[model samples]
Target: MKTISIIPVIRVLSWIVFLGLCIKAGAVLFTFTISLYNPPYAADLYQGLDLSILYSASRLDYIFLMAFAIILSSMQAFIFYFVVSIFEKLNLVRPFSEEIFLLISKISYFSLATGGIGLLAHQFADQLVKNGLVIGKAIDFWEGRDAFLFMGGVVLVIAQIFRRGIDLQVEHDLTV
Candidate 1:
């Protein structure tokens, strides 16, 4: 039996995920915009906030936010590819250098840390807004557990990133 290369598989999966995220983001933006124009719906939606005032804000704001989220999601996907690449490259090398392996490990650790921080911030803000708490006050609710799931998600992804790094390192060491 022949083993297939993991890097190509990961790249394909990353592209698929990125495309799916793009589609979802587009649908969300469309729905949000349509909701604004429908009178009865718009009245209910904009009860406290002024519809005209919100619409007057640049459409680019929404576009930019969506784009940023897409970019972050894509980055998470690419982290998978990165691990696969490391593994493939390690297999090609007769024996991996300890220094290089250490560097790779450090890089993975930092990437995971950064992603975790970002995910935490986003989840915290989202929960604050979702629980009927004002933004300023919600932010104060670090004591709040409403966003525990989101925090868990961040931790889960970070753990995955770390696992990938460890797997790549092991594969590299064993292949030679």
Candidate 2:
């Protein structure tokens, strides 16, 4: 039986992520433009949608909000890129190689960075609300970040396990 390599799957997923990033960029640009130019039309489009939170936003506020969304999307893209790197390294070399370990560590770091950034963004939004800049509740940027932080820590543990497997492989090789 031939084992299926996961490289192809990962590459496909990376392409999907790239596609999503492009779409998000376009949508953010369009949304910002609409919000700035036609408040009533924009409100009608968002009717019954929670984006009505944006109803009170000024043109500058819309620009700032869109910039925040772009930054968040970029961070998510970095996370996907890190996953692709790990998959590519695993495809080209031993799965237990040090390079894989380093890649996993990078995944952890990037995940942490994303979660931290989300937290900071949420805090900033809160401040904006407090200052009466954003009239309604700000979007919840930090809601799902706990999972990312946890996943980063879990990846570090998995990397350690892979390192131990490397040691076992070395021992088995030495026995020959």
lDDT value for candidate 2?
0.65
Q: Quote the positional error of residue 40 for candidate 2 in Å.
A: 13
lDDT of 1 by residue, 49-124 (tens): 2223222444443333333343444444444444444554554443344443543554455355435545564574
* Model 2 error, position 158 (Å): 1.6
lDDT per model vs. reference = 0.46, 0.65
Candidate 1 matches the true fold with a TM-score of 0.35
10 residues in a row with least lDDT, candidate 1 = 42-51
Instruction: Give lDDT: candidate 2, residue 18.
Output: 67
Q: Which pairs of residues have clashing backbones in candidate 2?
A: none
lDDT of 2 by residue, 1-176 (tens): 99997669778888788677656556655665676676664443322223345556555555565566556666667777777777666645345777777877787887787777777767766676786664332264346577777887888788789889888878878998
